[model samples]
Target: MSEFERIGPEPARLLMEQGATVVDIRDPHSFANGHITGAQHLDNNTLTAFVAGADRDQPLIVCCYHGNSSQPAAAYLADQGFARVFSLDGGYELWRQQFPEQIAQPDPHK
Candidate 1:
């Protein structure tokens, strides 16, 4: 689409159900603590491999702590050739609040 759009929890959930790839840009610890189910954590360490392997034409949703950081990250992914890029409005925080049942917590033993 050449640009990223900001989307709220409900719309993001719908897109996810339709096979959108969800990426969490928060730190590893934060991601491990709690994140959207099926979310892939992305950082500088994994960005290259992610971009190299991801389906550019598929919808992608970028998430962060409070929704601020994801804007630029979404933009970057859009620039990288993603056809539909979205930033989760209010980010993981709002998602957790609105859909706690959708959250995935890491197993302590893992």
Candidate 2:
């Protein structure tokens, strides 16, 4: 029950088109498998930098395995002063199902 918004793929896409930063909070393995194109992988090690560097007024969309975790994460970002924050409604699983073209793997050769 966070104050942050939960958005479906289309809305998320619109935000992306307008330059929202996409952050995937999934594990490295999950992230490596596939994620929204251009998403920044955020884990413990990179989180501090993410927090410091993320623009306070810029929109952000946070995604997790099933959409539950991202809600809290998104709220936290908003509390941290990120002006516009959103949680991917169905998470990456649903996004991949609905937007195969927007999915990306870091390196196919890896």
Candidate 3:
């Protein structure tokens, strides 16, 4: 019955500043290619385990290539008892477009 909140880039950045764990739910290869600085990588499938080890009380922000992948991932985290699970509203692509300096560029090979 819990719902995940969608947060914009500014708020997401604020959350990160306040010690929230920003998780990149993209695949390992994609993650390695590029991701938010300090983001923990956990592909969507392994989200549950990742949450188990993380601090549930702290805010958790999930992001993917375009936000699609993060929706269900955030929902799943919310269902798993995470009090504050949030999905990046526009994902990395938007972040890149909006804040180029903050966005990590994908690897050329990828």
Candidate 4:
């Protein structure tokens, strides 16, 4: 059984460097405002497709506004067969504070 674990920003970054897939559970607006670089936004409507197409062998990291919502989402992803699942501790808020340069904002011209 795959199990999800809680991880802080630093370790999460390290995992990302090792090719982990990162998903943000925040709403579209918040996700557009700022998110971890390379993060894919996943909501109810998009989750099924994501799960179906995702590479289960790669590490998956789930993030929410404050690290609370990601826990369940991470667990759910793990159950779906992701080998290494992580609920980002402190979530996007903490990640933003700790690694501001890693944040990606929508293009103003768009």
Candidate 5:
């Protein structure tokens, strides 16, 4: 089984600059409220395609409410053949606190 890396918000930001695909695993309601600027919200419904269609070589960063949940999810993703996967340390809330500008505004239409 493959394992994922755990990284702090700052390192996660660096990976984004390096072209990581950030995926938020929080519920849709929470995700719609706020998320990383370039993140894509994902859940059970979207996970299959997201994994199957994803570029295995591309880096992936998983985020959740707190740092806890993302570890298992990231490990699962990596096990699914994702070569490089990471779970954000301190998760989205911490990210929002430390990097307000990086948090994306909610879409009014959603």
Candidate 6:
């Protein structure tokens, strides 16, 4: 298993409040459905370009539907020199359950 710091919704919220950049790694379709507020949708496909322009100095919080995808994504960001990178413990699902107000609701028209 890969070593990762699993953060709960409260801590995640604090991180975001403190200027952490939340990166959602789910597919664009799923992202358009819903995601955390202010999260940047990079998806698995556009990671390279996203990282190129991303601020390495900023704290990065990565998330996915269940947390599986965000692990490697967070690791990749770390490898790319991001100072602080984290994966949401249980991904957006747990986040939604813990902080309903923070989760972005899906748009019906998509």
Instruction: Summing lDDT over every window of 10 consecutive residues in candidate 5, give the lowest-scoring window.
Output: 101-110
All predictions: root-mean-square deviation over Cα? 1.4, 1.5, 2.7, 1.1, 1.3, 2.3
Candidate 1 matches the true fold with a TM-score of 0.96
lDDT of 4: 0.95
**Per-model TM-score on C-alpha atoms:** 0.96, 0.93, 0.84, 0.96, 0.94, 0.87
lDDT-wise, the better of 4 and 6 is 4
Question: Which lDDT tens digits does candidate 5 get at residues 3-104?
Answer: 899999999999999999999999998998889999998899999999888888999999999989999999999989999999999999999998999988
lDDT of 2 at 62: 96
Return the clash pairs for model 2, or none: none
Candidates 2 and 6, the one with greater TM-score: 2
Q: How many backbone clashes does candidate 4 have?
A: 0
Candidate 6 lDDT, tens digit per residue, 1-110?
Answer: 33446687789899999999998988787887778999989865777888888888888899988888888878878888888889888898988888878878776665
Error in Å for residue 67 of model 2? 0.6
Q: Model 1: residues >4 Å from true position, as ranges? A: none
| TM-score of model 5 vs. true structure | 0.94
Better of 1 and 2 by TM-score: 1
Stretches of candidate 5 off by over 4 Å are 108-110
Residue-level lDDT tens digits of model 1 in 5-29: 9999999999999999999999999
Model number with the top lDDT: 1
Q: Order the candidates by lDDT, highest first.
A: 1, 4, 5, 2, 3, 6
The residue-by-residue lDDT of candidate 2 on 1-110, one tens digit each, is 33679999899999999999999999999998889999999888998899998787888999998899999899888887888899998999999999999999678676
